[model samples]
Structure formats: C-alpha cells, structure tokens
Target: MSNLKQELKENIIELLNLEEFSVEDINDNDALFGDGLGLDSIDALELMVMLDKDYGIKLTDPKEGKEIFQSIAVLAEYIEKNRTK
Candidate 1:
C-alpha cells in the first residue's frame, strides 16, 4: 500500500508536470484539487488518461474521478482494487 502511494505521488508529479511539487510535498491525505494541489479540470482529464494508459483502469464517468482522485491514499486504494496492469 505504501509503495502504491509512493508510486501514485511520483506518477502525479510526472503526469501532471507538477514541477514545483516534489514527492515529499504531497501528503497522502491532502486534497488533490481546489485548495490542496489546486488541480483543475484539465489536470483531471490528464489523470484520467494516466489511469487508463498506465494502470489499465478505465473511468467512463468524470464524476467518478472526483472521489477517486481526492488524494493519493484514495487513488492508491482504488487502483489497488481495480488495476489490470
């Protein structure tokens, strides 16, 4: 689980081009949007692509991403349960 969280953090930094934020900057429970990482709609789209392309997890509904992408912990848990790759 920890490994998955770390991987998720790394992937988020790389995929979203969060050059200002290192892995250490991201907290497992920190929000990924709004006041936390401040990721907007475009970043969400990129993450959806990342999920499909990197984890073989297809999310047909964007609204679903709101909960799944809430934080690294949540995302990692969701991926652990659903990842095909």
Candidate 2:
C-alpha cells in the first residue's frame, strides 16, 4: 500500500508537471486538489486518463472521481481493490 502511494506521488508529479513538489512533500492524507496539492480540474482529467491507461480502471462519473481523488490513501485503496493491471 505504501508502495502504491509512493508510485502515485511520482506519477502525479510527472503527469501534471508539478516540478515544485517532491514525493516527501505529499502526505497520505493530503488532499489532491484545492488547498492541498493545488491541483485543478485539468489535473483531475489527466489523472482519470492515468487510471484507465495504467490501472485499467475507467471512471464514468465525475462524482465518483471526486470521491476517489480525495487523498492518496483513498486513491491507493481504490486501486488496490479495483485495478485490473
């Protein structure tokens, strides 16, 4: 699970071009948007693509994406349970 969280941090930084942040800067409970990581809607869309392409988990509902993107811990858990890859 920790590995998943670390992987997520790396992927997010690379995918979003967040050069200002490092893996240590993000905590497990840190929110991925708004005041947390300061990600915007565009970043969320990129993450959805990542989920589908890397994990084989496609998100059809925006609301569901909102819930899953709450934090690294939550997202890692979801992937652990649902990832096909």
Candidate 3:
C-alpha cells in the first residue's frame, strides 16, 4: 500500500506536471481530484488510462472508477486486488 501511494505521488507529479510538489507533499487520504489537486473529469480519464496501461487494470466503466478511485488508498487497494501485472 505504501509503495502504491509512493508510486501514485510520483506518477501524479509527473503526469500532472505539478512542478511544485514532492511525494511527501501528498497525503494518502488527500483527494486526487476536485479541490485537493484540482483534477477534473479529463484528468480522471487520463488516470484511468494510466491504470490500464501501467497496472493492467482496465476500467470498463467510468462509474465503477468513482468508488475505486475516491482516494489514493482506494485506488491502491483496487489495483492490488485487480492488477494483472
């Protein structure tokens, strides 16, 4: 779980081009979308693709992602359980 959160921090920094944040800046419970990081629906789509490409967890329905991606904790748990790789 820690490793997944760490990786998420790295990926978010890179993927979002967040030039100001370090991995330590992100809290595990911090919301990845909305006011927390200012991410939107498009960002969610990008993240969904990222999860599919990097983790091999294809999210066929975006609605399913809502619960699975509420926060980094949930995302990591979902990935750990469903990841093909």
Candidate 4:
C-alpha cells in the first residue's frame, strides 16, 4: 500500500477507537459507516472533527459531510481532494 492509504487506515482506526480492527483488518474500500462497520451519525461527527484536526478541513455542514463520508474509499478521496495539509 502507498503511504496515503496506510496513513488513512491508521488514522481512521485511531480516531474512531476501532479497538477490534488492526490495520490489516481495515480494507481500503471498507464500508466505514452504516451496516459495514456499524458506525453511526456520531461517529461521522467524530470523523469530521478528525478531518479538521488532522487535515485542516472543516465540514461546517453535516449534510455536506453525508456525501463526503459514505465509505472509506469516498472519505479518502474527499480528503485527498480537500485536505489543506
């Protein structure tokens, strides 16, 4: 895996407190929300905070976040496109 993919996986696991998943358990295209990982709205909010904290991207609108955070693949693409740092 490239550094970006690895970093994203590690960050997601750490930021979301996914204690049951090691780095390898998190596939690059894993569904991070809804039925896949069982993450809920609150987890999405936490992940938004993580984006702001770690990537310098602030998602002020929760609705906007819904489109951006559909899954790990989508989230990574959004971050890659929007992250300031």
Q: Candidate 4, which segments miss by more than 4 Å at Cα?
A: none
CA lDDT of each candidate?
Answer: 0.94, 0.97, 0.84, 0.81
Which lDDT tens digits does candidate 4 get at residues 1-85?
2576788778878878889988888777767777677788888988888889998999999889988877667777888899897
Model 2 agreement with the true structure over 2-85: per-residue lDDT tens digits: 999999999999999999999999999999998899998999999999999999999999999999999999999999999999
Sort order, lDDT high to low: 2, 1, 3, 4
Q: Judged by TM-score relative to the true structure, which candidate is superior, 1 or 2? A: 2
CA RMSD of all predictions? 0.7, 0.4, 1.1, 1.7
- Each candidate structure's TM-score, on Cα atoms with residue i matched to residue i, is 0.96, 0.98, 0.90, 0.85
Using TM-score, rank the candidates from best to worst.
2, 1, 3, 4
**Winning model by TM-score:** 2
After TM-score superposition, what is the CA distance of residue 74 in candidate 1 from its true location, in Å? 0.4
Model 4, residue pairs in steric clash: none
Error of 1 at 28 (Å): 0.2
Which ten-residue region of model 4 has the weakest summed lDDT?
1-10
Model with the higher TM-score, candidate 3 or 4: 3
> Can you tell me which runs of candidate 2 are displaced by over 4 Å?
none
Query: What lDDT is obtained when candidate 2 is compared to the true structure?
Result: 0.97
lDDT of 2 at 64: 98
Clashing pairs in 1: none
Output the lDDT of residue 9, model 4: 79
